[model samples]
Target: MDFNGIKGTYDVIFSLGKNCLVADQLSRHMLRKIGGVLDWVESPALPGVSHLLRNQFMNFMEFPNLAITGINEHAGCYIVRDAAYHIFSHHDFPLPENTPTQLLSYPELREKITRRVPRFLDTLRSSNRILFIRTEGTIHETAELLEVLNMQVAGEFNLLVINHAPVSGIVETPWPFPNVCALQIPLVPDEFHDNDYLWKTLLEGFHVRY
Candidate 1:
């Protein structure tokens, strides 16, 4: 299960076979080195993370590597993006016309996600038994968010949840408080789950080699 000294790190270079949504996203993530499931496996092992990360789609410890043209920068912690790509790429997907994939730089992404932070904090204040923290960074930074929140929270919501995979579904996590639950209520309807059939339909047409 340990790929400690495996010879698999390489830049990603994949050709556009057919235009597909899931494939495109996977391609983008692979291009960015952020969406491949194997990347998560090679990531530093953290206690209890595998439970939230490993699912039917990406339970593999080591994925077969192919010729790649990107460095895996976030090799420290598993990315939820990769896990999401796994779930999404599992079903039958429909091919689309060739189109450009819109990628957000970390700064742009941070700004967009934080645009509503003020309004969100205002809403969080109304709830008595809950504490909410929302920050935009790599998906794995949920640990840092909780680390800071743990010290800040006095007796707020016993639940400390991080809804990082906004576009994809995530598994349940342990409650911060023994009796309290981590309430990671979504601000908007989860697009991934809301259009599950669409995703299921779109993932069927692609093959993932990483």
Candidate 2:
């Protein structure tokens, strides 16, 4: 999965300016390349956690092969809440020290969201899903990060990791998963270009065409 959104919020906080446009275009391109589609589901746009989970779960039920990516750590907490009733629910995970209950006031809710993002990612790792995280900083070598992601995605329907910067370093850790692959590249101009490169790379690497 390709990620070209803001950290924590998963929102397209880029402005309408040229650089922002370039970034958005690059994101779209990457999505197309990965044999995936990008959709912007803002937090405010949804009624709440339950609504977001219900909508995504129903959508996935209709398209099991489809994978939803680009959710930040904060947004992912709602996923845990939504899956709470399931047998292998994420609700079993322990909350972090600073996370406030929803019963708290608005400021508390905001603080909780900020603190729980990392915890949410940890919880998400236990689930069977695929989640692509966008790293910070400039684009660079990323072989090491890709290796980590490969292990995380193997067997699990869902995976989560931090995208701290561009892919640049070589993998020093042992590779775990053979099936999953991570593709890292510099940001492009638009979705069309991004898709072209993404599909080409996948086709070459995995013989899978987008």
The local lDDT score (0 to 100) that residue 173 gets in candidate 1 is 43
Q: Give per-model CA RMSD.
A: 18.8, 16.1
lDDT of 2 at 134: 27
TM-score against native, each model = 0.23, 0.23
Clashes of 1: 17
Using lDDT, give the best candidate's number: 1
Q: For each candidate, what is the lDDT?
A: 0.29, 0.28
lDDT of 2: 0.28
